[model samples]
Target chain A: MLTAQVLYGLTACVIVALGLRGALLHASLLQRVVAINVMGAGVFMLLIAVAYRGPGLPPDPLPHALVLTGIVVAVSATALALALARRLHAEQDND
Target chain B: MNTTNLLVFDGLLLFSIVGLAWASLATTDERRSVILFMAFGLVLAVAWGRLLAPDVALAEAAIGAGLSGALLLAAVRKQSPGSSHTHANPDRNYSESGAKVVLQWLVTLLCAALAGTLAWALLHALSSAPHDTLPRAISDNLVASGVSNPVTAVLLNFRAYDTLLELAVLLTAVLGIFSLGQTTPGYQPAGPVFDGLVRWLVPVLILTAGYLLWVGAHAPGGAFQAGATLAAAGVVLRLTGRSRIGLPDGFVLRIIMAAGVGVFLLVGLTLLLLGRPFLGYPPAWAGALILLIETAAMLSIAATLLLAFVGGQPQSTAVNAAANRQREENSRC
Candidate 1:
């Protein structure tokens, strides 16, 4: 159980780093948006790993619930960001 | 499965998840990148299941992987190919300068350091004795929480304020999208075959959404999942060139958009007036109250998500006129 938890946790850390690198280096708004979502997914993986107890035992429900809430919020934020990006592109077109 | 098998499975899953995330961001092509990101979300959903979070896995598959992909794809489709504005400004040559390369290295190192620090912190936290206080309290109080599913209990009862706030955030997001501009002109109508498929598919999706909402009290489903499924039906309609996409006009649309937060706040405030703490439901009433709130939330979430996918304020008057013309033509036929 511990082995699995540590493995997922470490992998999540690496994924977060990759996402951060992409977010910072990528110039496009869409790539930045994707990068940010990736970062969020990594964070969520870490939380789920922490919530895990073993193969059979029921895990922590708090983190599971929190992550569920986070998923919906992430989508909403993505929608808003895409809308803003579209608006920006339209404005640039008029100029 | 046994420990070794589980270990191997976890290893493979995490590897693919990381690889997919890396590949998605590595490309500069918008459509390809978004498609890869969607794949990443699906793989991540499987990982969530492997970690024993079925509720979260369901949500991730539905909202994270499914709806997010749809929204991103729509945005990509709308981008006018002639305008290089939305694309990354790849025209600027960064490789020509030594300082720029140095800055890139610094940024990479900084991100690596951040990852290292986080991993170190996680290792320490995991090594320590796990905190069982809250979980124990939750278990002790589970019977009175009015739901068999602990995650749903937490979402609708123990930490309902958080869910309430989340609905507000969703409301705010849709409003922002509305303020941006009008929705794109809808798709060309589906052909006879697709039209036949949608005729049956939409009803099935709506039924599944209802089942999900009802089953949430005992299983790995809830308002969020149900709402997303419902919104997907709307998306299918919009994609098939339905002008109104099943949404009501003007005042009713705004009401549906506001329903989640409005109903939640009203319930919380009413409980406060009854001399209980905010959202503190009496055990006998808790189940009923959660059902009421979840129903309203599901509607709002569905409307808001569909509206978000539409990408802006849907022109009600124009859509109504178009629908009326279609109706006249059908009557004549």
Candidate 2:
């Protein structure tokens, strides 16, 4: 159980790192959007991990709600980012 | 499973999630990355289940994998490679200078440090912090809160404010997409087979989404999940050329997009003016209010999510109409 908890927490950390690296290193706007979302997922994992009480206890609902809110926020953010990407590409075409 | 087996399985699940996420982000092929991202969402849905959040797991599967994946895929389909303005900009040419490499290293270090701190906080906070028992309070009031499911109760009753703001946020994203710039020519795959598949699937999709919404009162189904399911259907419709990018013209479009937030605010304010708290439904009216709100929210969420995939509304529906006319002409020929 402790291993489950620690492994997930560390996975979150690695995911955040990988995503941040992608966001920084990638040139394409779409890639950046995807990276940022992965980073968001990492944060969500961490939030959910904290909600996991040891052994028999049910996980916390508040964090679940918070993560749900985060998911919605993420979709919208992706939408906006993709929209911006589309516009950027169109602008380049015109030029 | 023994504890050892459980740990190994958990480790593997975490591995797949992190691995998929990395593969999605690290890939040079945009389309492959988007596809991998979808798979990542599905795996994470399982992780949510492992965490014992069925509501979230349901939501993650529908919204994260299904709708979000389609949206990203549509965005991917809309663009031609190397078209973005950044391609022309010198800033993207990071290989030209020694200074740039140094700066890159600095940024990488900073981000890694940020991730490290977050992990440390996660590890320490759980062991040290006196986390309050919020579930007890929620369970204590579950009957009067007007929902049997604790998650639903938290979403629609006790923390109704969060849900209200959430709907507003969805609307805001739709508005942002609308205000951004333009919707590219929509992707309507041309084929009789595609059309037949879409026709067969849409009604089933609608039924499933509605069933999910209705069951949300006592189970893992709810407005967000239902809405995303509907949005997934809309995505299919949009892709198959049955539905256009943006819906009917701007006026109806605005109304549909605004419906969720508009009704939610109205109901919440009505309660406040009637000497109750904002978002406080009368005990007898809770189920009715939730159902009504969820219905409105499902529509609004579906429309907004579909529009978000579409990217933006045009000045008129005429653009889609013209495309339809062209498609008809091609079919006739």
Candidate 3:
């Protein structure tokens, strides 16, 4: 049987690759945000995949929790960053 | 072969992600880019759910996609119209020199190789022996922790020290943002339609936030989730000019900010006084104590983040009056 881990691992690789490309190639701030987010997703996927090794053993719930917390923190940080960016844009427009 | 099914699923995921990457890379408009990024976050959240990390999925959807998108959009709106001039246009010089292109490819190759090696090493390591001491310890103490969710148990009990530090980091960030110049830039007041909507929506949001906070002890909800919801409400109110900047450095604000840290330190100190190592949970009060701390932490976090977003202390009465007046004006109009 093709295990879920193998599928997730491959997916993670693809995500990371895309994220790196977005980060590097995209000159716009919006594109950079998307790239960083993609990277975060890739990392999260890897964590979940790692948690799914054994059948009898319960999955590693700690990483799930940590990643969950990390997501919220990331969003909050993103929001604040976006606010700053927006203000900068407004100021530039005025100038 | 079951492996074939797995491969197909993996392929689908890979295809979607690759497409998104390509689209994002090709997009020159920063505004559209942020929106696409939000869409990408939502897709990633789905992938997480499929990977059996529902908790992560919830978090990703709410914070990653929802909040982050809002932040990005807000930033885009605030930017100068001229800033759009910086975007790469097809007509412009888009090609790098041969050396730069070669270096870029080399970097991409190196990153891919390193990532592949790391994944392979991890899989190999995990397959062998399979003795995970940390997971074992958590599972063993799950019942004692009085939380069925192993993740919650670990966060609130086993490794609470980390959680405490994380709260500190959040508080620090909020404070840092506060130190930045005036956050509440005076804007033209909202129209009657917007004012009417805020009047109806604020209470509903607060109620939902409370429900989420209470559900967090057992399910996918938690203080962070609740706090974010509450902060959303605060942000809405602030934006509508229903809340004005008040003294951010007021005594009450300081206490609320300190409440989480103070409770944590007190609890740790109490453990030390009882001759146990710091943060060792007392069997009798562990669950209650953790919940109490979490509640305090949630309030402080919500308030801090909201204030940080507001970029100043809100003048509570003025904003409330403005909202009230707007509501009246809406009815009259």
Give the per-residue lDDT of model 1 (tens digit) for B180-231.
Answer: 8768657988898888888898999999999999899989999999999999
Error of 2 at B142 (Å): 1.3
In model 1, what are the clashing residue pairs, if there are any? none
Off by over 4 Å in 3: A53-58, A76-95, B1-14, B81-100, B126-129, B184-200, B239-241, B244-249, B311-333
Give the best candidate by DockQ.
1
lDDT of 3 at A30: 58
Q: Name the regions of candidate 1 deviating beyond 4 angstroms.
A: B81-87, B93-96, B318-333
- For candidate 1, give the DockQ: 0.79
Q: lDDT of each model, Cα atoms only? A: 0.90, 0.80, 0.68
Sorted on TM-score, highest at the top, how do the candidates line up?
Answer: 1, 2, 3
CA displacement after TM-score superposition, residue B72 of candidate 3 (Å): 1.7
| Candidate 1: clashing residue pairs, number | 0
DockQ of each: 0.79, 0.65, 0.48
How well is each residue in A1-95 modelled by candidate 3, as lDDT tens digits?
A: 12667667656766776677667765555556667777777777777877765344467887887786677566656545554555465456456
> What TM-score against the true chain A does chain A of each candidate get?
0.97, 0.94, 0.83
